[model samples]
Structure formats: C-alpha cells, structure tokens
Target: MTIACILVILPFCLALAAFSDLFTMTIPNRISAILLAAFIVVAPLAGFGMGEISLHIAAAAVVFVVCFCLFAASVMGGGDAKLLTASAVWFGLDASLVDFLVYVSIFGGLLTLAVLLLRRQENAILASGIPVPQLLLTAKKIPYGIAIAMGGFAAYPSSPLMEAAFRATFVTTA
Candidate 1:
C-alpha cells in the first residue's frame, strides 16, 4: 500500500506541475510542497536507511542552492527551482542524480528551442484556426516546469526510492 502510494504521488505531482506550466506558465507552489512533504514521509516508510535519507536530503540541498542562484539571476523561475529541488530528493546523491540533471538540461534546451521556434511562428499560429495557450504563444519565459517534469519522469525509474519500492514489492521469501 505504501509503495503504491509512493509510486502514484510522485508521478501525479510531476504531471500536475507539467500541465499547470503548460497552461499557465506557472507551477503551483503546492505541487513542490507536496513533492517535498511526500518524500519526507515516504522515504522512511519505504525502508530507506538514515544514511540514504540523508543523502537524498543532501542532494536536494545542493540542487536547491544551485537553483536558488539561477532564480536569483533570473535565469530560471522560482517555481522551477523549487520543483527541481524537490524532485532531486528522490534521486539522492548518486548516478541517478546525475542522470536527472543531464536529462533536465537536455530536455530544457530542446524545449527552449521549440518554444523559440513557436514564438517565431506565433503570427501564423494566431491566424490559423487552431487554438493554443496564450502563455505559450506570448510569454517570453519558457515553461521549464514541463522540461523538469519530463526529466523527473525519465530519471524516476532508476532512482533509489523507486528501486527501494520495487524491491519491497517484488522481493519475497521462498
């Protein structure tokens, strides 16, 4: 039951952040809060040891510091920083964290290019009958939460927390 809840919560929150950013160009603070709170509550229940949990917290702290600097410089939005930090907690200080960062950077760059191209064609899109979100067409900021969410989902399957959950669910006594 706990594993099921853990699996559901993280993906659900990631999806929410992506969709919210797609529609509004903003990731609600509540989504980041839920992610951080859920990690705090579920990591232990999922049988993570103190050392592992501490590593996860450390990873989140490092991510938060870097993201905070980015936000301070106006290179990224505050909500994107919070979401990235919270999501980093699941990866811990391991190869998975590196994977998440790499995926985020790649996806973020691709998303930026796509958005820039779309913005270049905004007039044609507006003239067409197809409807698009106004924020997507007009906002100068890229909806980076979508890229972050994509990176989160991409890295989640290999994350320590998910590995622990898989073991708890599948490992059985003979």
Candidate 2:
C-alpha cells in the first residue's frame, strides 16, 4: 500500500517540478535526477518480473532514441527528450508509445494555443496605446516539462485503482 502511494505521488510531484522548469525554460538537473532514481527503484516493485522489466527498460530506451533524434533535428529540447525517456521507464509496454505521443501532442497543442492567445492580448494592448512588454521578442521558451508532466500524470495510477476495485469484488469468492 505504501509503495503504491509513493509510486503515485512521486511522479505527480516530479511532474509539477517539470512543469515549472518548462515554464521557465530551465530543466533542473536535480529534479530530473530524482525522477530517474525513483523509476530505478520503483520499476522492480511494479511486479512485471525480470523479463517484463527488461521490456519496460527497452521501451524507455526506444523513447530515448526516438526523442533524442527529434532533439537532434532541433524539433524538441534535450530536456524534454530525457524526461520522456524517464517517464517511459514507468509507463512500460502496456501503454503504447503511440498513446504517449498522442497525449504529448494534445497537451502541446493546448500550450501553443494558450501562448498564442496571450501573445494576441499583448499585441492588442500595445496597439491600443497601452504599455506592454514585447512578448514576441522577449517570450521565453516553454520548458516542455509541463507537457511531459501532463502526459505522465495521465498515464499513472488508474491501473492501480482498477486493480483494487477488482480485488475487492472477488475477495469473498477467493
């Protein structure tokens, strides 16, 4: 029970840290290291056993390779790639890479929309003779940890909830 709780909470907290870093365009190594360490500890406990664990590790490796390639092409940040790979360690094979990528795309779209709207507002203010910062010129890059965190949050813990409910239902029979 305690392990389950830790597994659930730690990722959520790390997601928040990631979000903050993404917002500020800074990926704090401390937070990234902590997340990686947590996965190293928690993966074995997730009970897929050794072969399954290897598969999960492979999934993470794939994520690393794919995302790193994107980063190298200048399509994504290195931090985002590392964070996604670390997230894959926890996600495992049950969660398809396609779905993970979908979640990221959806979240990225939302973030882009929000920033665009904010930029528009800034433009309007400047046009109306109101003092405003040059948002287009001075806007900091979105850290992207926010989107990764969102994906991780969506991927986590609903499985455990379902498992618990299923166990309760079969308790008397078992």
lDDT of each: 0.92, 0.64
Query: For this target, which candidate reaches the highest lDDT against the unseen true structure?
Result: 1
Pairs of residues clashing in candidate 1? none
**Residue 152 miss distance in model 1 (angstroms):** 0.7
Which 10 consecutive positions of candidate 2 have the poorest summed lDDT? Answer: 157-166
Error of 2 at 79 (Å): 1.2
Top candidate on TM-score is: 1
TM-score per prediction, in order, is 0.97, 0.74
**Per-residue lDDT of candidate 2, residues 1-174 (tens digit):** 535544565466556666556446656666666666775665455444677667767887888888889998998887777777876766666645556666777887887777667665875666787653353325655556777777666656443322343454467368
Q: What are the RMSDs of all candidates, in order? A: 1.1, 4.5
Give per-residue lDDT, candidate 1, residue 28: 97
- Which stretches of model 1 miss by more than 4 angstroms? none
**Model 1, residue 89: displacement in angstroms?**
0.6
The TM-score of predicted model 2 comes to 0.74
